[model samples]
Target chain A: MKLLYFAWVRERVGHPEEEATPPAGVETVADLVDWLRARGPEYAYAFAPGAAIRAAVDKRHAKPEASIAGAREVAFFPPMTGG
Target chain B: MAVRLQREPFDAGAEAARLTQGREEVGAVVTFTGLCRRGADSGAPLTALTLECYPEMAEQELARIEAEARARWPLADALVIHRHGRIRPGEPIVFVATLSAHRAAAFEAAQFLMDYLKTSAPFWKQEETEEGTSWVAAKAVDDDAARRWDEG
Candidate 1:
């Protein structure tokens, strides 16, 4: 799957997008966030617990528990500030 | 209905005119423009604002919001245009225009579109000041505003 970061999350993660394969047990958005957090200090900082992060799976807004099975893209970002 | 995401600035007046050009039956036209301001969070002068978005997702999300507004209101036409990239203070960042047969529907639908766009759209804004730059944090008030639409 392709993982995307935006706003400060992208700045912390140091990149906008990347390809990654999660472990078999990583089934939901929260699990994937945990997995990314373990990749490095930057990823950890970006996905740190209590961070105001939001997610979208396949271009749709999703909650932490939303399933990501067979998804092509997942995006993580701060709560949107658009108007 | 039209939703456009662009990097260039948009003319709000032209957009509003296009929406109501030949539509005599439209009694109300509500147009809203959101602009970048000169002040930062720290009371410093903000030089510019950098706006970014997931291109495909932003377009899809805006379309979804526009569709919802149409579903809830009897709209004759609706147009949404949002700009991304570096914008100077006093420059327009977004424009929304809604036309209907009555003032109530046009006014409410335009507000609904803006409220949802504030919270759900896939755009992020970063403010640049003399000291440094920082991402603008999302406000709880915006979430509350969006949520109010769900209740009776």
Candidate 2:
């Protein structure tokens, strides 16, 4: 699966997008966040607040409880401030 | 529904003109322009506002919003133009134009689009202030504005 990061999340993660496959139990967005936070310091910082980070699955807004099963792409970022 | 995410500044007059020119069915056209502003938190002097977007996602989200507006109202047409990258104060940042057979539909649709874009769009803004750059904070009022559309 491909994952994307934006804004400060992108800056902290040190890249915009990447491909990764989580372990067997990492099935939900919340689980994914916890797993990614354990990957390294940068990932840890990016997902620090964990729940504060917003996410989109397959280009649609998704809650943290949403399943990532069979998903191709997921994007994470802070709440939008666009007008 | 025409949605564009570009770094180039768009001519509002031309865009508004193009959207309603030959469409006689469009009795009203409402346009809203968002401009970069100087200073933000702590009163630091802002030199520019840098906007960032997730290309595919931003486009998809915007298209979905446009589709919703069209479905809920009798829209003749609609256009959304949002700019990304560095934008100085006084420069236009975004433009939304909605056309419908009557003024009420156009007006409401435009406002709805703006409210959704403010809270749900995948765009981030950083203010390049004299003290340095910082991301703009989201406002609760924007969420409340979008929530208004959910009621009867």
Docking class of 1: high
Return the top candidate by lDDT.
1
Please list the C-alpha lDDT of all candidates, in the order they appear. 0.94, 0.90
Q: What is the C-alpha lDDT profile of model 1 across A1-83, one tens digit per residue?
A: 99999999999999999999898999999999989999999998888889999999999999999999999999999999987
Instruction: Residues B1-152, candidate 2: write the lDDT tens digits.
Output: 89999999889999999888899888999999998777675587788899999888889889999999999989999999999999998889999999999999999999999998888889999988777889887788989999999884
Candidate 1 lDDT, tens digit per residue, B1-152? 99999999989988887889999999999999999999987789999999999999999999999999999999999999999999999999999999999999999999999999999999999999989899999999999999999995
**Cα lDDT tens digits for candidate 2, A53-82:** 899999999998999999999999999988
Per-candidate DockQ versus the true complex? 0.92, 0.87
Q: List the candidate 2 regions with Cα displacement exceeding 4 Å.
A: none
Report the error of model 2 at residue B54, Å: 0.3
Model 2's A-chain: what TM-score? 0.95
